[model samples]
Target chain A: MEEVWVTGAGMTRIGRRSEPLPELMAEAALAALAMAGLERPEAIVVAAMNPEEFVGDGNFASNVASHMGFADVPTLRVETATSSGAAAFYTGFAEVASGLCSTVLVVGGEKMTHIATPRVSELIGRSIDPYERSYGATMPALAALITRALMARHGVGEREIAAVAVKNHAHAARNPLAHFPTPVSMDEVMASRMVSDPLRLLHCCPISDGAAAVVLSDTRGPVRVAGVGQGTDTLALRHRHDLTSFRATQTAARAAFTMAGFGPARVDFAELHDAFAPFELIALEDIGLVPPGKSGTITLDGETALDGRLPINPSGGLKARGHPLAATGLAQIVECVWQLVGRAEGRQLNARVALAHSIGGLATNNWVTLLEASR
Target chain B: MIPTTVAGIGEIVSYTTLHSAPEGFRSPLHIALVQLQGGARFVCHGAQTRRVRIGSLVAIEAVDNIYYFSSLNALDRARLFWGRAGRAGDRVNAMTRSVVRRLFKGGESGPN
Candidate 1:
């Protein structure tokens, strides 16, 4: 395989927006291409978790490519539910790495704020196992069940879980592109309305409308795609042996580390999928960045904060960064690129190697991608 | 595959009371993940979430293609039997037929 480098990364401000899905994606696409100093890529990999349901558009790859004025480019759509963006990135990475294409553009986005909250929940909930969904298990419901199990098994407290949201929101306050870019206190997060038992509204990422894009090429660039790995598990949550940790994430992290030729200790900072706040702590342990059962204590102790020893979610994470389903995975990668290149303005941290983790449906599909500044 | 069912008690592994339910579902929906005594596990709806504790045993009932779980009183078990036996037989039969058809078509084995 040939070497792959991230030439450029761009993303729109996440949250409710008036633009259509294609337009939002085009904006990010254009920005990324401009940053890469390229008119268009040899191939385009588009990702939208449920554009047919969320935006009433099918044949998304062709739709997005043409809309972005790359009408003749080879295009395809890649999806793994909520982690569609990262899946698209992997496709683009393969296209460049395998010499299928010299350059590729990977873009992902979602539009859901246009729908009612219940309807949005219903649509997103479609990702859940049908039997579980029939039991009225929405995303938060399933996450709550996991959170409860995590608490029971690890003695993780409500305060510890709530701290994830607090720290991310504080970090988001420094991020102009964040959805909830205002600081939220522990008292406020703890007092937030309960969406699902043991998981409050603050713990949940909002239904957002946004897009993110990245340009990849075999040519040397500022940031090298050090490693990328994907992992999948049984869709039904009941089939898994352990509820506290995600096997998919572990598998992906293992592959990523193997490719990077190093262990987790070398990662300077990370952008974690905190779609639900507890996931941050869970991802930390699953990726071997933190010792098992120590994530909660260190997180609550401010070790994962922006100025801490190992900053997590310097992009505000999916929590405050806004989780626009498919857009989230690419956004996380874009944030890593920004931080590595010293573009993450106020929330910038001293970093070189960065890792981005994304989860699809209920931790069933996960991806871990590592990046390093090409000095 | 042959059609079959598991009837027994299971412990609630974890549960949640959902305040903002999906469309066509009522708010404050109580859902639980249960691991049966025989080791089979599934998600089930609950009538009440109050007093429900993790590791507490609850009986499972199949009615209208959905599983309902709770700590049952004698009256509750009788009501479940009556509902499953005849009260909703026609509708349950229709759903069961669809489920069997889906299974034959290489779909999910369990009813949605």
Candidate 2:
């Protein structure tokens, strides 16, 4: 198999935007193409969690490619719920590695701010199992369940969970493209109204509208896609063996590490999926970035900050960076690429190897991606 | 395909009180994952979580094809009877029947 490399990366500011979904996707795709110094790609891969409901559009691959001035390009769409962007990247990577396409354009985005908050919640809630949803289990509700279990099993305090948001918000303060660029105080986070018991509004990501894209090719580039792994679990949470940690994340990380031929020790920094604050700590442990039950301690010790011993979510993560559904998975990869190429500006960190983790549909589908700077 | 059924009694494994619910659901929704006597587990909606605790026994009642969980102890049932006036007797009767069915399903072994 041919090696895959990330040739270019680009993303729009993640927050409430007026631009339509296709326009946001085109902006990111065109910027990535310009950065790669290419006029077009051999194929295009598009990702949108639910444009059918969010933006009232379908046949998204063709729709996006046409809007981006790549009307004749071969294209397809990929969806794994919230991680649709990362799944698109995985598809593009496979296309390049298998010699099916010399160059692939991967773009993802979502526009949900135009809709009512409750309506958006209902659409996103469709990803949950029917049985669970029948009982009114929304995303935050399920996350709160997991957070409570983690707290009970690992002795992780609510303060530690809130700290994840604080650190990410601090990181976002330096990220011009972040949805919430203002750093929030711990007290503010603690006092934020609870969306679910034990999980405040501050602990959850906002409903943002944005897009991100990347250019992948078989040829040499500054950043190599060293490994890509995907893992999935049962849709119902009750079927899982443990609630504290996501088995899908652990499985994806193991596959990614094995493919890269390097363990977590070699990772200089990471962009973790922090859709909910506590998930950062849970993912840190699941990815083996820190020992089991130790992520909270390390995080509170300032070890997961931008300038910490092992910076996590230098892009502010889905927490402060704004999780724009399908846009988030690709945005995380874009952040990794920028950090590796020394273009992250204020939030940049000295790093050669990076990891990006994404969770889809309550961790029913998850992905792990490894990148290395060739320099 | 044969449809499987779940026991009407279980212990609360994990639960949450949601203040921001979906479009059709009411806010402050109390949802819980309950593991039944036969190890079959499922989610249940309920009125309140004030008396509910992890590992506490709950009786599951089906209303309009939707399942809800309530504390099954006698005192809790008595409190429910006294808490409301109209339809109090019907509610108590339903709760007692559910409790009896759960006990029979367990065959004296009770929830773990």
- The digit string of per-residue lDDT tens for model 1 on A293-324 reads 89999999999999999999988899998999
If candidate 2 were superposed on the true structure by all CA atoms, what would the RMSD be?
6.3
Worst 10 residues of 1 chain A by lDDT: A148-157
TM-score of 1: 0.90
lDDT of 1 at B40: 78
Error of 2 at A349 (Å): 0.5
* DockQ of each candidate, alpha-carbon based: 0.32, 0.33
lDDT of 1 at A217: 96
Cα error, residue A304 of model 2, in Å, equals 0.3
In model 1, where do residues sit more than 4 Å from their true spots? B1-6, B72-112
Among residues 3 or more apart in sequence or in different chains, the pairs in candidate 2 whose N, CA or C atoms overlap within 3 Å are none
